[model samples]
Target: MNKTKNYDLTIIIPMYNEYENMERLEKKLTGYINKARMKTCVLLVNDGSTDGSLGRIKDICERNTDFFYISYDSNRGLSTALNAGIDNTESRYLGYMDADMQTDAEDFDLLLQHIGSNQIVTGIRARRKDTGFKRMQSKIANSFRRRMTGDTATDTGCPLKVMWTEYARRIQFFDGMHRFLPALFSLEGANFKEVPVRHYPRTAGKSKYHLWNRLRKPFADCIAFRWMKNRYIRYEINEKEL
Candidate 1:
């Protein structure tokens, strides 16, 4: 676990089968890294994309010194990829965005501004470009999630988020952990802020989520989160010496 403290931020992009979006993603990310307020790098997590995504990822990493990647043999879903990135990142700050490129990489600057005082800074997609049905689904899901988790996050599903690496590594990873980040961070006594960010339509890769996984599964996962919250352990020591 060598902590490479040289970089101030590491952005984690989780890719499943987004081969089509790789070229544009690399260009946009490279532009961000070049102009970021702090030293920044990218960590591409390839969640076993059967499409030729791994090859593209390797090529991208080879071309950019600030880019890196990790891949597994089988698809493990977004939460697993996120946890892997958190476990491996050594930067002071960590960020997450989808490979589909619906959110702008430059919005990370907006989130980074709040990272000094908050454990997590997440984005709320203002004037979302998603279809009406997708927005409706998100509305219902967010409403239910707020009621169930009491996280009060208007848009937990928004992939653009930045958090202190210490707090991010403390998050408990589960099948649907991505949807409960704010709640899980809260369990660790972490505070977060939300900023409005720009959103774009998906021009390249198809979205991986659908009605069942986006809505029904999240409802079930919320129940699971509540159960874990009830039994979650927390303690503190008055004094300690190493």
Candidate 2:
């Protein structure tokens, strides 16, 4: 699995106005990079952060040899940032996490242990540390999306995940496709694994999602996913000539 990669893994961290969490990101990520089971580097994708996050990202990347970055002129939202990160990834396996630090960085090792066989291995926030209201909203959204797309996912919203570069690139790009990472990979008969991991409360920065996007937007995205699922192409070649 690691044979063809420049590094064994490339962890993609997408930031949007996360100036407050920059130092935390550096500290947490550096610790993981040093102790990770596989050779790992980080790609910090800047989504046009207005709170001086891009500058901090630059400094972090400059000081750390394992860190690199790609920047956009302005904010283009999470899905776009995720796609760009995947597109730029040069490793055989790609990992993803949020800048908010709600998810533990060390738990990525747990997800990585399952990626050798599965095309996608994602974390499940077994014990989420959010308010009851926030948890309820996520629960409702997850249920609705699962019913609509027929996806057997427990917590696709968990930012910590590891996927083969091929599978990551194969995912069809859409505005809210990040919410359906499991379904997108499974759509092509790709194997997937779900592992329970630690979750934490947001200590700094603001949550990008809210009542509308958290609940309503996913409903619309599920409909979009359903439409695209029906139309998405699939194929297998017993023999081929190039």
TM-score of each: 0.97, 0.96
C-alpha local distance difference test of each model: 0.93, 0.90
Candidate 2, pairs of clashing residues: none
How well does candidate 1 match the true structure in TM-score terms? Answer: 0.97
Q: Point out the worst 10-residue segment of candidate 2 by lDDT.
A: 1-10
lDDT of 1 by residue, 100-123 (tens): 989999999999889999999999
Candidate 2 segments whose C-alpha is farther than 4 A from its true place: 1-5
Displacement of residue 36 (Cα, Å) in model 1 is 0.1
Which residue ranges in model 1 land beyond 4 Å of their true spot? 1-4
Error in Å for residue 240 of model 1: 3.5
Superposed by TM-score, candidate 1 places the C-alpha of residue 5 at a distance from the truth, in angstroms, of 3.6
Error of 1 at 233 (Å): 0.8
